[model samples]
Target: MAESNKHLPRLLCLHGGGTSAMIFKIQTRRLQWALRSTFKFVFVDGPFTSGAGPGVLPAFAGCDPYFRWLNPESQTAEQDQRRVRQLLSKVIKDDGGEFVGVLGFSQGARLTAGLLADQEEQNAAEGMPNWKFGVMLCGSFPPLSLSFAKMPSTKPSQGTDEHGETREPDEDEIIHVPSVLVRGTLDPHGEKGRRLVKYFDPETAIAMVFKMGHHLPGAAGDTTSDKGDTQKIVDAILKVYADHLPYEELKAPKTTVMENRNGQLSA
Candidate 1:
């Protein structure tokens, strides 16, 4: 028989900082299974190698060769956004699929927010495709505007803040895309996640605050409630998908399916 769900819309999966695509795939295995009929999840690695991130050890130990999307110590925010733009362009071009949305955790979540901002404020003018939605899980920090102005040489830190402890989003940075923003109550970045919510249009945003740390729902030593929490996220994603993309268009064979690209660890 022919593939049953060949027309499922694609949703890109971006791993958190200090993690690899393989690890994220493993981390989100249950979630993928939950949404298997609704979406085809594509996992990709970040470009920069780095040490493991918070809440990654003791369980995901030996899962070496971790990676990050940006290195604040070396690259300016402007430089990092450029690299991220190139990385995304390459991924989208290579997949050749209908990218309906993206799902990201932690640092990846921050990048997802920035990706939405850039798509709206910059890339759309260049004919780049727009994601129908975004899913940010345990995200921290406000996103860097890809169109940030050049910093003056005399005051190199004029337009960006590498360590923005309580940074706020500018009016133009408020994303209008439908999004599911997940937050863990016990996470250190929980407050930041709250701040991040203001960066999205409240009308199109869904906030899910759970009682856990800075990790995906049902990850590691999560409680029995994990399954329920995970289901909430799944429901939210489905709702966003339904609200953003029309059912007929989602069923369109020309754009819903990927070309020859199998979901792999693309960097």
Candidate 2:
């Protein structure tokens, strides 16, 4: 590895539903290439396989094997949550460094949002690493019943109660981490993406809209290969890291991280 990339901060890259890490990697090749110098992207396959599910992306039509972070048919929300937490923990341990950030598309983005929210509610003693920021590309918010949905608000709100006296509302749960939400104007899930953004603090979240469809576009209106769009995404990712994590932390060694089915960590 080049000296500049030797200590580059690691970012967990989550693939969309019905798309494996390998597939997503290819899908976002240009963007990833542009960002490789500044960040080490770790792409992981989701736990559930997409078996003839309705509404799966057309690109996965004959892919034979596809994956997802959550499977409503075979797993409950709690089970899926535990699986994600374990996978992240194992990856961090295997890498010999903590994940500075996360970048996800579609279902993966949704999972990332949920994870960040969950981290907000956790006690420091739990030993989970707090991600500095996240990039959610076409992601959605998890159900309110999840732990991330319970994050207590640190900011005060100014509003009048039923009594007509001005006062701050009770501390409500909110994800405090800064996030960049990327949405395609033509995507059917665009509305869901908007709803997810509303869950975060208005001041901390940034929403970027592209002119294309469901997938991560390379240019303003091009879904596949637009150098300009790729650079924009790359810039957005780097900015989030720069605004949050220390520069010194970005220069950490890369190591092998893996987890067994039992959730035991090993390198």
Predictions in order: lDDT: 0.73, 0.64
lDDT of 2 at 222: 57
Off by over 4 Å in 1: 1-6, 124-128, 148-163, 224-226, 247-267
Show the colliding residue pairs in model 2.
Answer: 7-251, 7-252, 94-256, 94-257, 151-173
Report per-prediction Cα RMSD to one decimal: 8.9, 11.5
Residue 46 alpha-carbon offset, candidate 2, angstroms: 0.9
Expressed as tens digits, the lDDT of each residue in 1-267 for candidate 1 is: 015545777888889999989999988987888888888888888878999988788788998899988775865766765666677668877877777898888889888887787777755413236788999988866664444542213222335443454445557668999898988768887777877888898778877777778888788687723567787677777777777657774442211111123211111
How do the residues 38-143 of candidate 2 rate in per-residue lDDT, one tens digit apiece? 7777888877787633244465567658887776685356566566667666777787655678788887888777667666767321334678888898775441
- Show pairs that collide, candidate 1: none
Worst 10 residues of 1 by lDDT: 258-267
* Candidate 1 RMSD computed on C-alpha atoms after optimal superposition onto the true structure: 8.9
Candidate 2 global CA lDDT score? 0.64
